[model samples]
Target: MRRGTGHLMNTSVTVWRVVLADDGGGGQTEAWAPQGEQPARLSQPTARQREVGDQENAHLTHVVYLRPGVDVRRGDQLRQPGLRLEVVAVFEPSVRGTYLRADCTSRQAEGE
Candidate 1:
């Protein structure tokens, strides 16, 4: 636990990276490879954030908080049970070593 972050991450999500694999036809196919799981706290965007996303047609949905040094990045996929979120952006606090935040969009159809 880092300072006040004790137990803040109440759940874990598996992080997946899309890799290009040889399709044996001189072409590559995108494949989802698990990058392992990490502790995370998934939250819905606030009213203001939601409004901004709506105006921009971004469909931004969840904000995921993870401990610093987690191997996550934009374009990665975060998955838990019935939900899948596509990571849109990754941010680090100015103070550093506090936590990492990921702005994500819901991929409802993929989960179905």
Candidate 2:
């Protein structure tokens, strides 16, 4: 992922379906809401994460600041457990950062 290198970027965004559980107070509660799906704008390693989080993801992390129409408060999709995202966004020149690998990005969408 270097500058001026137009690699496979369009298939870079990681799309995920967010199921938000409501905080209900009754015995029969906790309804799941289908939040609008969003993508994880990926970027190259910052030299810091490369040394951390073992070597599985090695240095991959979602760039929250670059994701448009996404809430900057909390990365809801990035926080979801067992969530493997699918690549959908048509890649173009990001006015923010560079996307790295497609291993975790190019997944098929989950069955509804």
Candidate 3:
């Protein structure tokens, strides 16, 4: 998540939903969605140099669109209206004009 200087000045924050896989053997792999308001403060960022695109973008939202630990496929759900997206390809923004997409298989979301 990138924010402009102004947004940072205003104490910008967001929520991240990461999937944790279960290793079997009485273990569980559940996705974690932080409840309530949590401030996201990065002490040392992997990305140092900031650019114009570093500014706040609409794609990153305060809430997780796909939800946590939900078995989502390539043609899963979409958040934005008129926003055609897919999970088929994972894109790295640093790679220039590369667009990311994904395709969900028959995998069921853990704890779904």
Candidate 4:
């Protein structure tokens, strides 16, 4: 994969970061805060890929590709309409400037 291929990212997704905010009762509460939205390519992994994830205990359901240096991280949530995916891991190509890949698990959205 080469850099500057904008067409590869056909879909958009909002990135949510998990923040621990202080609760009024002197406790910290976890909240999802929207970082921003960006173009991405999302796809369901094949059986072989799924099996690899399963063996690694990642339970990956989807793979998201974004521009290299995107701020996505493990535990971040990628949302689009009725879908919400929890990122299990983030991978960068050793060659650099290729693309960022996030292995995610699909979770049920509240409205769906």
Candidate 5:
């Protein structure tokens, strides 16, 4: 997607990575560390269902657009207000490299 494609990216997302932290018991705990923030255009969420084992899993997927050359990787997460999106894949959707697309999955928050 181009920068001037009439899509106003007013929302900013903070990128986070899971890191191992010492728990003082010789074990490590998975914690989220903020990598950085970036301007992103969030597409409308799409819902789908997939069969896993013997149960069906429902999840939402969103396409996030960011500037070209952004170092986004799989397993990273994008955090916005009241939303957390786990990055499933990252690729350049356009041939001109104007922006990068991050395919993310959103599930219901715990205890919801």
Candidate 6:
């Protein structure tokens, strides 16, 4: 893999991490803090459908590819223009430090 091969990654996305901040009243507030932005490619969306009780629910799983050394982790989020994807897992698909692949799920479909 080569760095120049990332030309297909045209989507600009913001990476965010969840932080717990003290609320000053023996509680904490969960907030999303922006980590940074990166050029990424989102693809391979698969529909996951299941039945809970008498209702059927569906969610989408997508693969996100980022440049090497992009500090993305599980539980982080990637936000695009009209989409919010929660990172479920991260891995180096090529194992050559060329890029990072994140398996993400749609936050809206998860009812989050």
Candidate topping TM-score: 4
Residue runs of model 5 more than 4 Å from their true location after superposition: 1-8, 24-27, 45-60, 94-96
Ranking by lDDT: 4, 1, 6, 5, 2, 3
What is the RMSD of candidate 5? 4.7
Q: What digit string (tens of lDDT, one per residue) describes model 6 on residues 1-112?
A: 3355378787878999999999999999999999999999988654331122113222336788898789999889899866889887787865566788887777863454
TM-score of 6: 0.74
Name model 3 segments beyond 4 Å from true: 1-8, 26-28, 33-112
Candidate 1 ranges beyond 4 A from true positions: 1-6
Give a tens-digit lDDT track for model 2, residues 13-94: 2233445454565435433244544444455435554444236543343332233334322222322344443322223245
What C-alpha RMSD separates each model from the true structure?
A: 2.1, 9.1, 13.8, 1.9, 4.7, 5.3
- Model 1 CA lDDT for position 56: 77
What tens-digit string does per-residue lDDT give for candidate 1 at 4-69? 453799999999999999999999999999999999999999989888877877678999999888
Best lDDT among the predictions, by candidate number: 4
What root-mean-square deviation over C-alphas does model 4 reach?
1.9
TM-score of 2: 0.30
What are the runs in model 6 whose C-alpha is more than 4 Å off? 1-3, 45-60, 109-112
Q: Ten-residue segment with the worst summed lDDT in candidate 2?
A: 100-109
Worst 10 residues of 1 by lDDT: 1-10
lDDT of each: 0.89, 0.36, 0.29, 0.91, 0.75, 0.77
Write down the worst ten-residue block by lDDT for model 6.
49-58
In candidate 1, clashing pairs total: 0
lDDT, model 4, position 37:
96
For 8-101, candidate 5 gives per-residue lDDT tens digits of 6667899999989999999999998999999899985443322221132224367788877777898999988788888877888647566787
lDDT accuracy of residue 97 in candidate 1 = 84
